[model samples]
Structure formats: structure tokens, C-alpha cells
Target: MSSAPIAAAPAHILELARRVLEIEAEAVRALADRLGDDFIAAVGLVLASRGRVIVSGVGKSGHIGRKFAATLASTGTPAYFVHAAEAAHGDLGMITADDVLIALSYSGSGEELLKIVPLIKRQGARLIAITGNPDSPLAREADVHLDGAIREEACPLNLAPTASTTAALALSDALAVALLDARGFGADDFARSHPGGALGRRLLTHVSDVMRSGPAVPRVAETALLADALMEMTRAGMGMTAIIGDGDGDRIIGIYTDGDLRRSLASGCNFSTARVADVMSRGPKTIHPEALAVEAAEMMERLRISQLLVADREGRLVGALNHHDLMLAKVI
Candidate 1:
């Protein structure tokens, strides 16, 4: 006979889950209470270092170290990760005297780290240790030791690393945020670092970059017939046309759109004989070529309009764009 499997009740599983969360939350909260001069010193060390921060660790601590390096790098502090074992195998060349070393070890006694830390110190690089035990050799030798010690692991057996890693990650994030504030890193500065992202594109792409210009801009003389204006709008695919003063003049007298055409037809205007200037809307909303694309999107939304005329400093129609173009550019 085959033995039947046993399953824990839903209530029991839920209780276990809640207990794990509570333990982890307590571990993070305890970190704040433990902060003192050492936390401040860690922030100062990174802020004062002229070169990058070199983060090193082994096992689960190594994974947290990678996150620590990324957070610091993204938040205005230059940092990179080096595996503790790899450092012993010639990756130590990446470290320099000007750089600061941040080593992560929950037990403060990873053999690979022990082998690498001494060589790093010999190079004159300052050491900062994030460890669970302050009495460990790693903490004793570190110039500044961050106390990541927790009362116990969230694991029921207290053998697997759980609370300790969470405390270390949170503490490292605190250091990065403090250094970011000290550097006065702003949105513009972050955009420069991440120019390929959507936020960077929104901030850096100008109206002129995406606006239809030159012959693609639908334009007609103010005296042109409604039929002629409609032809230009259809050919340009912008759903609207700019009606400027006669004789190739640069001044935008008004704008005539598909909506205007509809209203004109509703009012019984003769499209064949009526002039564009006679029925077109005057004082149309306009944006400058130098403005950000995101600014143009905002203006269109606020006015409840679909298209905007791209004008120059002198108010001459230089280009044109509509909500469709903005959507295509992913700016809206």
C-alpha cells in the first residue's frame, strides 16, 4: 500500500507566513535603533572617497553586495561589486588605494573574504564591514563596522540567513540615500546618467525633435479657399492646417481644423467658395520649438486640443504636431 501525503492546514501555513513577515519587519526596525556614529561614519567615508566604492562578499552576502553596489551607483555614488573568491584570483587588480572597500559577511568569517581583505588593506584602501557579529575578525579589522546583527533568523531553524541579509540590504540603502542627499543629486542629474530611459527621453526630447517641419507642415495662405485648406490638411495627415497671411508671409493668421470644417458644414457654409480666413478659428494655441516634448503634451491636455503649431521666437509657424505624433513618440 502507498502512503498518503500529509498537508498542513491553510490556517497553519498562513500563521507561519505571518510569523516570517513579523520577524523580518522587526529586524529592519531594529536597524534604525542601532544607528549611531558608525552609520554616520559610513556615509562620510563614501562621501569623502574621491574614487569609486568596491563592494565584495561571498554567498548570500555576495548577492546583497551586488544590490548595494547598484543602489549606490544609481544614486550618484560610483560603485562596483567584486566577488570575494574572485578577488583572490586576480580580480583584486580592480581595487585601488583611492577606492573604499565595503565587505558584506553575515558571520564576518567567510574564508574567501578573509583571504582577500588583507591584500585589499595592504593596498591602502579603506575597509567598511557589514557584519552580524562585531566581535568577528572582519569587524575588528575594518576601519568602520556597520552593525547588521539581528536577534535571530526569520527561519524557524535559525540556521539559514534571513533577517541578517534583510538588515544589511536596508542599512546599505540608507547609506546610499544619505550620500545622494549630500551630493544634491536632482532629476536632471539622474536623467543624464539614464539617457536611454523613458524619463530621460521625456526631459531631453525637444518639440522640434518630434514635430513635423518644412513641407510636411500643412499650411495655406489666408485667402485660400476652404477646399484648398482641406486638401493641405489631408495631404499632411495632421488633421489641421495653418492659415498664414497671403503672399508666402510667415505670420500665422489662424488655424482651420477638421473640427472647424465640421462646424462650418453644420452652419451651411459653402466649402467651394468660402475662404479659410472667414471660418477658421483665430488665436490658436501654439508652442515653441525649443520647448520640451513633455511640455507640449501637457499643453495639449490642458487645452483639450489635439494639435499645436510649433512657432519660433517671432511667432512664425515653424512646425506642427498632434496628439498622434506625441503618442508615437511615447511622450504622452
Candidate 2:
């Protein structure tokens, strides 16, 4: 008997997937186009909220909901994820009257979520629902219904929630960026929200915050001998020392460093007999203590100096910073 030939998927299946993608892309674009007073009102509601945003969903929607909460929290907004299944088991306590609760369900009828809707309402927390079926029970009960409805799924079986989830994720990102913009949130503000990250160190760390201050600052008077300045440089481990003069101390007369010492010794200058003024490099580069650490890095790169003397607004020596300091603070 001849073996039955293996069946091949019809071209229609592939075509369906492509059509789903195109249709969902249009859905997202339409959502963007519909941005108007309602979008602004939603942002205002979130901004005025005194408590965190509580995101809850069931099944695949639950996974996407967690990511949405994380994205909002990592940006400027305070948000957290609550499992819909857990809501009935006292997880409802997580919701507060001052908070905004966002419920996500593609079908708008997750049994687990429906079990808690009345309780969430009783707690007086405002509810926002994202669902494909605007007339679904959840949407009917929501204070605002965001249309996450998609025409179809990318899955050939048409059973998986594919296009709908993608649309919801994109919408969540749009809301985050819109809120960030509305608050005039700057890079510095973002850095504050993420101090442990590299972007935070680059943006939020100021020269003064990481610089060596007080006794850690390498300093020597101009009248001090070259040997004493060299000792200060070595003891401080900054490879350099600032030379301060008398009076209001507005002037930086000279800077003595390991390189200067080497150059002086090679030029046959007597280290013991030489004064710091006679051997030090005149008018070395300096930076304000309030300058951003990134700006200080740029200055160091331009001037080819590993060490920088941080001065106050009056140009008086306040502290010192080095490339190693930047590296330690992770600003480099």
C-alpha cells in the first residue's frame, strides 16, 4: 500500500499571519491617531494619583501586565504587578483608594479577575480596563475602557492571544512616554529613579559628589619646597597637587605632578633646592565642583590630565577628582 502523502500547510495560513500583522499595525497606528482629550485626561488622572499604579491580569495577559508595570516604575511612575488569581486571597489589600488599578484581559472576561472587580470597586480605587471586547462585562464596569481589540491572532489556529498582546504592550509604552513628557521629566530625573544603573551614574553624579574632599585633597603651598609637593602627590595618590597662594586664594599659581617632577629632574633641576613655584607647571586646568562628572571626563580627555582640581564658585580650591574616582563611581 502507498504511504499517505504528508499534508502541506496551504498558502492561506501564511497569508493569514501576514494579514494579522498588517491589521494590528494599523490598529496601533489608529490608536496613536485617536490621541486627544481622553489621552490627556488619562494622563492627568495618573499624575494626580497619590498612590502607585496596580496592574493586574490573568494568563498570558498577566505576563504582559507585569512588564508594563515594570516599565512604568522604571520610568517616572510608581507601579507594581498583582496577580489576578491572588487578588481574591487577600492580595486585594494591595489596592488602595488613592491608587489606579489597570486590568488587562484580551477577552475582557477572565474569571479570576471578575471575582475581584466588585471588591476593587468597593475599595474605591479607580479602574482602567484594556480589552478587545468593549461591550464585555469588564469594560462595562471600568471607569475607562482602552480598546485593545485586534482583528485576529497571528497564530494559525486563531486561538493564541498574539496580536492583541502586542497591541497592549505598545499601548502601555505609549502611556509611559506620554506621562514622562507631560511631567517634563528630564534625564536627571530618570537617573534619580535608576541610581544603580550606568545611565544614572553618568547623569546624576556631580563632580562634588565623588571628589576627594578635606584631608583627601592633595594640596601644597606655593612657598613649599618641590619635595613637599611631591610628597603630597604621592601620599594623596592623585598623581598631582594644587599650589595655593596667599590672599583671597582666587589664583592657581601652579600645579605640581609626577610628570612635572620627572620633567624637572630630567632638565637637571635640584629637587631639594627648588621651590614648588620654580618647578611646577603654571596655570593647570581646573574644574568647578558643581560640574557634572561627564563634563569633568570630557575636560580631562581634552586636556590629557588624569587629575583635576575642583574649585568653588570663587575659584578657591575645594576638592580634587581623578580618573580613578570616576571609575570607582562608575561614571567612566
Candidate 3:
């Protein structure tokens, strides 16, 4: 690697950054005051449409449009992004007569968007324009025009599209969220759309999917010796073993864990011949295998437990799980 001297500027970098944030924040805050009849119309139009919601824009506005489309798509609104330039290059065919198009153009005069707005309208697709100019051609052509007009830009030279883009993005979010609420979208719907993420796993994974069953569950009869419980726990590597009564239809008598072992040793109990029932703790916590894994995790966390037993309605042990099992399932 070659050593090079770093170049330094003489301006107050932090002050300029702060001023930019203040301007953008004010621009977005002003949007709430502008939520009039037009905003409502836009939301109703998208909600009532039989087809998808297509978000289109160019440059910085295109970036925001992509995020807006993704949010809408994940929140139960069928939506996707189409670049304005690409639309003019034949992507416009994707828009159908029953679809709703949300066009983002801060200046309301982007040539690429204006070139295709007429085609979209002629095809019977409704247009929702988000722009800083109300009287511009694109805004005039829209079925619903959302005025994102800002007094000043965040740029120091007042040339870059900073505050204007931020306002347009915030407006897009407002419209998408309004539509989401109108559709009665919930967390389950969101999780369904994001099944590969942690939120999805937490909500969709059931205890049965992660619990140890059959041969994997460390269990022993109440008549078994303390050494037997220890052997079962060691074989299963779960740090605990379930103790069940022999004549009581194998009904749970108690649970023997390392904690119980420690206490028994501290009490000077002889493990060589002592029964597991003598040292096991009774009335151990249990869970249903059909319950959500996250619920099990919550229960364990609330009770400060490292392991839990899974039983059916008849009180028969079906499975077992511990913190390590939960971690393996990515449910912790």
C-alpha cells in the first residue's frame, strides 16, 4: 500500500450536515398538514383498484420508489417498481387498465415520466403524481396530485433535490401505510411475506418444529435410580431428565436436572442407590407442542428456565425442549 496525505476541507462539515437534516425534517413534517382530500382519493383509488400498484420514477426519486413499492408489496398491497426510463422503453406494457400508477417526480416535469403519463392514462390506468409543482404538466395529467412542494432544498447551494425528494418519499410512505391499514393488514400477513427473516421464523415456527421427541427426550421412570437419570441426561445432552411414575400410566412425577443433582449432593444424599423421585423437582413447567416457539421462549425467559417439557392434553409427555434446542432452531 502506498502512503498518501489526506486532503482536508475548511468548512464546518457537522453544521452543514445538521442544517440539511433540519430542512429535510421540516419538509416531511409539512406533509402532515397537506393531507387533504387528494391524499384520501389516492389511497381509495389504490385500494379500490382490481390490479397491482406500480411505482415509477427516475434518479433519486427512483430509489425511493423502489423502497415504497417493496413496503407496499410486503404489507398486503400488490405493488412493484418500474423505472420511468424503462417504462418508456416498453416497460409501460406492464401497466394494465385496472392498475393504479404512483408516479414520483419532485419537479413534476421529468421528461421520461411525462412522455409516458399520457400512454398510462390512455390505457385507462389511474395516475397519482407526487411532485413539488402543482401546475406542472405531469401533475395536471394525474387523477390525483399529491403536492410535495417545499420552500427550500437541503442543499447549501439550493440546487440539489434534497428536501424535495425527502418530502416525496415521506408522501409515498403515507400513501402506502394508509392503503395497508385500509386492507386490514396485520403482523401475520407481514410475516407471510417475509418467511425467510427472523420475524417470520419467530412467528411461524411452532414448538413441535424444534422440540426433541421420542428417543431424543431424556426421560426415566420414578423408580429409576439417580444414576439412571444422570445417564439419561448425559445420553441426550439436554442437561435434564423427566421422571415419570410407573403405575400411574407413566404420568409425570417430576423432573431431574443438574440443579437437583447439585442440591442432592449438597444434602449428602447417596446417588449410588437413591431413587430419582427422592431428588427430582415436582410440578415442572410444561408447554404444548402446537404453541408458537416464541411463546415458549417468552415463558422460559419469564420463568428463568433453561428447559421445558411438552405434553399433550392428557398429560402425557410428548416432547421436550431447552434453551440450546431453541437456539438451534433460531427461535431464541
Ranking by TM-score: 3, 1, 2
Model 1 residue runs over 4 Å out of place are 1-6
Whole-model lDDT values for every prediction:
0.91, 0.85, 0.91
The sequence of per-residue lDDT tens digits that candidate 2 reaches over residues 59-105 is 88999999999988878889999999998898898889999988999
Model 2 alpha-carbon drift over 4 Å, by segment:
1-38, 48-50, 214-216, 227-235, 246-252, 258-273, 288-291, 313-316
TM-score of each: 0.93, 0.79, 0.93
Candidate 3 residue pairs in clash (backbone atoms < 3 Å) = none
Model 2 CA lDDT for position 328? 93
Q: Write the per-residue lDDT of candidate 1 for residues 69-143, one digit (tens) a residue.
A: 998888799999999999898899999999999999999988998888889889999999999999999999899
RMSD per candidate (Å) reads 2.4, 5.1, 2.8
Decoy 3 TM-score against native:
0.93
Model 3 C-alpha lDDT per residue in residues 170-235, reported as the tens digit of each score: 888888789889989988888899998898999999999999999999999999999888999999
* Worst 10 contiguous positions by lDDT, candidate 1: 244-253
Best by lDDT: 1
Per-prediction tally of clashes? 0, 0, 0
